[model samples]
Every structure is written in C-alpha cells, then in structure tokens.
Target: MIDVEVAVAAHATIGESPTWSASERALYWIDIKKPALHQYIPESEALRTWPLTSDVGAFAFCEDDSAIVALRHGIYHLDLSSGELDLLAPPPFDPRLFRFNEGICDRTGRFWVGVMFDPVAPAPAHQKGHLHSFTFQGGLRCEDDIAELHNGMAISEDGKQFFLSHSREGIIYRFDFDSALGGLGGRKDFAQIPTGIGLPDGAAIDREGCYWCALHGAGRLRRYTPDGNVDREIKLPVSKPTMCAFGGEDLDEMYVTSAAEGIDIAEEPLAGALLRFRPGVKGIARSCNTGAVAKMARVAKRRID
Candidate 1:
C-alpha cells in the first residue's frame, strides 16, 4: 500500500473533484452541496473559491479561459475574471428531476457530462441517467443511456478507450471510442470495486495507464491495473473522498477532494475538504479540447430557438 498524506485541509462540504489545469499550473475542484468553485495553486499556497447560485457538478475550461459548468438548472459559461454566469441552454430533456454529476473533456475538447438522480430522492423512471456530449455548436447531445448513477470518467492516453463508472453498481465500463464520430462501442466491464471497500467515484489515469479511483464512502483512494488487479491503496483522512487528479509541475502529486455532507458525526472533520499527497507516479499528459466549446455554443443557440 502506498502511504497517502493530507496536503491541505479545505474543510469544504461535499467536495466533488480536482481537475488539473495545465495552463494555469493549478488544480480546480468543486463543492457540490455548498455550491462553490475552488482553485488551488500549490506553489503559491493560494486557494480561492467562488460561490455559485446552483450546485456545480463538473466543469471544464474553454480555450478562451472561460469555464463551462454543468449545474443543477442547466449548463452555463462562467467568466472567471469577472464572475459572470451566462446561461447556455438546458439539457434536452427535463432536468427538474435530475442533475449533472461527474464529467470531463474528451481529446477533441468536447465536454462529456453525466446526469444522475439526486441521491436523497427516489430514482425517477424518466431519468435513467445519461452521458451527454456538449460541443459549442451542438449544445447537448445525449450520447449514451447509462446506469442510474454515472460517476468517474477517464480516457485512455491514446484516446481509443473510454472508462466510465456506475458508482452505485461499483462497476466500471470500458468502451472503444471513435474520435471522428464522437461515438463509443464495444462496451465491456473494466473493473469492479471489491465489496465493502466503498463505491467508486471520480478517477484519473497515470502515465502507466493504471487507473486511480476515489472510493466515495470508503475513505480511501485505490490504484488498479488496466485489467482490474488491485495494485495499491492510499488511505485518506476524510471518510467521503469524492475524486482525485494528478497535478503540480511534475504531475507527480495527487490532489483529492472530499465531502463533509452525510457522514456520521465521527467523520465530520474529513468532510468538505481538499487533500493532497505525493505518490511519485507521473500522470498522463493533459489533453486539450479542440473546438468542442464552439460547437456547443451553436447547439445551444439552436436549442433555445
């Protein structure tokens, strides 16, 4: 087992994830239940947060430096400089009963977002959950019908394979991806979380192609080979670790986020905080979104009309 240590204590409730921003050399994440966006710069020991009107599930930065966020109400573009929120367009179907969850950008720069029923509520029939791809021109296209809860997402270094998680089912699926068509096929089970550990949430792939996953209720982060063999476990100080990513100049440091909401009183200190550790594993190179945001904008305009 690899020893994991806490780097920072954010004390955020429902801390969702950490995304490496190569351009800024910083880490970005969110506090879903708290409805805030956070950015942490390791070198400068700088941490900043912006409050949002709605829960922010996930987001990716556009080439123009604005952030596109998946929120409970709909999608919107957030200008980090001016703190402006520009509503794009709502999801194609009714989102009143569902909300966005885990999401990331594809190699082509399109933002791929997933939606799931709020855990506090009973599952809705019309809401089977879905994976949607958003381009600046296309708005939001339902890409695939997913399980009731879709979480962690990772793309292979070659961009030929896509990994998605069914958090509640504790299973991860691998699909062959076609970059040209923005489609997926040949779905196969990739990994299954060992019973009793915890359900899987967000994940990141290292340069070795090994997947490192955050175990939501387990208070641990685990690494597994591509074939699903458990390799290492990094225990966390928080009981509700939500997601992780490799950041810092060398990409050798792992930054994790946790949630303070819904935990037993004993685990309260671990809730709603950001944590980090150095695992000495180099991460895969960060990929950029080519023109996906532009395409999504066009799609949003058409959908609005």
Candidate 2:
C-alpha cells in the first residue's frame, strides 16, 4: 500500500465531509468547521466548493442529483446543481441538546445517522447520544442510544451488520441489523482504539470486507478485518484525519478528510483539508439515495395492486 498524500491543503478549520457519488464519479465532502460543501473530481483534478448557511454535519446524494444534508439543526434537501437548500425534517429528538454527526445510506437505501450533544451546548449532568435510521416510508426510527461521543458509522455489504464508533470512548460496536424490520439486535464490541493512538472517525469497507477507518487525532488511516484485527496502516502528513472512502473508476483510490479542530494555529497550518492515496484495494459499491422520490414510487405502486 502507498502512503497517503494531501490532495487539498489545510484550507478549512475542521473537515468531516465524506460521501461517494457513483453517477458523478466524484467524492463529495464537507468542511464542518469551515461550514462548506466541497466536491472533488479526481480525474480532472477539478474542485468545487459552496458555502452553506449552517453547519453541515453530513450529506448523501439524492436520485435527482440533489442532496440530503444533515445540518446542526435538522435535515435539508440541497440541489447539487444549483446549491439551493430546503428543509426536510426537524431534528429527531431534542433539538437544543443535539446535532447531527456522522451518517451513511445502507444497501436498502435507508439513511442511518448519529446524534450527539452539541459541543457548543452546555454539558448536561448525564447526557447520552443516540443513533437513528430514517426510511422513506417511515420517519426517523431510533436504533440505539448508548454512545457518549458518537462518530464513525458503516454497514456490512450483506446488510446484516452495522458498525458504530464512539470517539470519546475509543470503542467500536457491531450490531445485527435487519433492514426490512428497521431494527438493530445483538450489539457487541467490534474494536477499541488504544490510548494515544487516534480516535476512530469515518470509515468504509472494501469489496474484500476489510474496514478502513480514519484515525481522527493520530494522523493515520487504518484497515481492519471484521474480527477487529489491524490489517494495515497508512500514516498521514496532517493530523486529525477525519474520514475516508474508496473511489475512482476502478475503486482503488482512497480519499481521506482531515481536521484542524485542536491543533495550534501555528504548529500545523494545513490541519483541516482533503487527502488521497492508492492502497491497492477495491471498495464496495456505494448505495443509492432512497429519499422521498424513490420511496414514494414504491408505495404508490404497492397501493395500486
């Protein structure tokens, strides 16, 4: 495996955006601290970015080339072609205490997201974060609520397992998943971040079933087997590697995002930025957006019979 390279310089404060768009053949990410949405086309080396009206935590592509974004306040529909934003749903639970963190679409097109206590909000005496799964037919359904500091999330290729990480606790959990029933069962420990290493952040799985994760504070990206064994490690030049995904025509290129959250302004100038590398492993195909449009069609067809 090759070492990682800085694709984008440290132009933002905290970068947490990471999503793969198959149709556009591009990787879309957000600079959460900078509060912007960015798209990168690796083949042409073309980069496009747009300023957002609020702090966007994560986003997924819609069928019509638009996007569904999870902001600090709620979920919104964003027109990728024009950059227009429209509200979709309010926050699932207590709006004042929580904000959207990490999210991904499962194979069945359900959007799964995590909510945590807002860093800017006052710390409650006993606050616990939550994980939620949103289907097109049903609204937001609670999956789990055990994380202290919710972070990275991923699902298995067969849609039978789900992985979730708690950055603060430095542990990853695996769950038995049932997509049709919209429920998670039999949670167990998956991985644990050793102290002084980096906290686990965003993650992706390759076609071979290895889990690749960004080590948020340790300046490294690691690949692990399903049993939680470390398979490989790639050190980064920048600290705070936030997230990563595999893309490119052949799905060999690994894209990463970094953050500048806790670094001194002078120590590492380019703290929050985008990075890329070739790790020689193929990634699984990304799931399609099952937003309102696709979900409605399925319902209408079923009703006609």
Candidate 3:
C-alpha cells in the first residue's frame, strides 16, 4: 500500500466526519471545534465552506441536495446551495448534558446519531452516551443508552451489521442489524485496542465486508475481516486521525480527517490535515437520508400556507 498523503492541509481543530458525495463528486467533512462544514473538490482543488452556528457533530446527505446536520442544539436541514439552516428536531436529551457525536445513515435512510456528555458543561453526576435514530415518517427516538464517548459508527454494505465504538473505553462493538425496521441486537466485542496502542475513532465498511477504522492517537488505520480478525493496518503521518471514507470515482481511494485540538502543531506538522491513500479495495457507497429534508420542507410549507 502507498503511504498516506495529505489531500487538504485544512488544519481543522477537531476534524471529523469524512463523507463522500458521489453525486457531486466532492468530499465533505466537519471541523467541530471550528464549527464549519467544508467541501473539497479534488478535481478542481477547490474548497468551499459553510460556517455553522454551533459545533456540528456529523451530517448525512439528503435526497434533495440538502443535508441533515446534527449540531449541539438540534438537528437541522442545511440547504447546500443557499446555506440556510432550518431546524428539524430538538436535542433528544437535555442540550446541557449531551451533545451529538458520530452519526451516519443506514441503508434504509434512517439517520443514526450518537450523543456523549458535553465535556464543557458541568459534570452531570451520571451520564452516558446514547444512540438515536431519526426518520421523516417517524421523528427522533433514542434507541440505546450505550457509551461515554460514542464514535466509529458504520454499517455493513449488505446492511446486516452495525459497528460502534466507545473511544474512551477503547472498544469497538458489532451488532446484528435489521435494516427494514432499524433494529439493533446481538451486540458483542469486535475488537479492543490496548491502552497505549490507540482508540477507535471513525470507521467505514468496504465492499468485501471488512471494517476499516481510524486509530486515533496510534496514527494508523486498521482493517478487520467480517469474522473480527485484523486483516491489515496502514500507518498515517498524523497521530489523531478522526475519520475515514472512500471517495474517488471508483470508491477505491480513501480519505481521512484528523484533529489538531490540544496538540503542539510545531511537533506534529500534519496533525490536522486531511489525508488520502488507497486500500486496494472499494468501499460501500454511503446511504443518504432519502427525502427527509424535502418532507420536512413540505410540512413547514403547509403550516405556513
């Protein structure tokens, strides 16, 4: 495998959520601490950004050229063309206690988002991260009370499996998924990173049903087979890779986002830049939140009318 190379020297503070838009042929990601959504067009080397009001955890593309964004306060509809944000739902829990974290859409177009206790807020005595799902037909619902720092959210290409990670605890979990009903069960440990090795961050599923995950603090991307065996590992130049996704025309090229938060950039030069490399396997195309934004818009229109 080729060594990972810098794709964008964004220097994002808490870069996360590397998402590919095949329709637009651009890669979108977020800088959480900076509070912005960024679009990078590799073809033209052009970059565009939409400044967000609050820290955005993650987002999923909508069928109608918009995006459903999970911010600190609520989920919102972001019109990509006009940069207008409209609220879709309020925070599932008290905003002061929890803030959205990793999120992705399933094959059935349900947006699944995870939430963690806000470190900036006062200590909530007892709190745990939770998983939630949202649909146009069914509103937001908290599905599971899962972890402390939820990350590494991904689903298999065949839609039969789901993976989630508790970053602080260094455990990646696998669950049997019912795509039709958006159900999760049969949870078990997929892998665990030892204390000095790395913490599982963001993840993606390849065409071969293998799991590709970024190892934050370890500076590596590890691929695991369907049977929970390590297949391969690729070292990255930066120590804090936050997320990875496949994006090139053929879906063989992989993109990674990193964080520079609380780091001495002078020592780690490429700490926050977006990186790219080839893993010799294509990735499953990301599923979008089909018609959710459009449906919400129609509802608001009828109310206005």
Between candidates 1 and 3, the one scoring higher on lDDT is 3
Report how far residue 20 has shifted in candidate 2, in Å: 2.2
lDDT of 2 by residue, 174-202 (tens): 88988777678898988899989979899
Tens-place lDDT per residue, model 1, 1-305, is 55565556777777775888887888888888788788888778798887887878888877775688888888887777777777786765455667888888887777888887774455446446778887776667888757767887988899888888988788988899866678888889888987887999999999999999999889888898988888988888788898988888888988888887767746376566678788878887545453644445545655676
* TM-score (C-alpha) between model 2 and the true structure: 0.90
Best by lDDT: 3
| Tens digit of per-residue lDDT, candidate 3, span 1-305 | 57678999999998999998887799999998799999999999899999998889989888787888899988877888889987778887777777899998988789899987776777647678678887766767888647878999889877888999988899999998987988898999999988998889999999999999999999899999988899999998899999999999999999999999878999999999999988889998888765465667556435434
Order of models, best TM-score first: 3, 1, 2
How far out, in Å, is residue 113 in model 1? 0.5
Top-TM-score candidate index: 3
- Lowest lDDT 10-residue stretch of candidate 3: 296-305
lDDT score, candidate 1, position 103: 86
Task: Select the stronger candidate by TM-score from 1 and 2.
Answer: 1
lDDT winner between 1 and 2, please give it. Answer: 1
Q: Give the clash count for each candidate.
A: 22, 1, 0
Q: Which ten residues in a row have the lowest lDDT in candidate 1?
A: 286-295
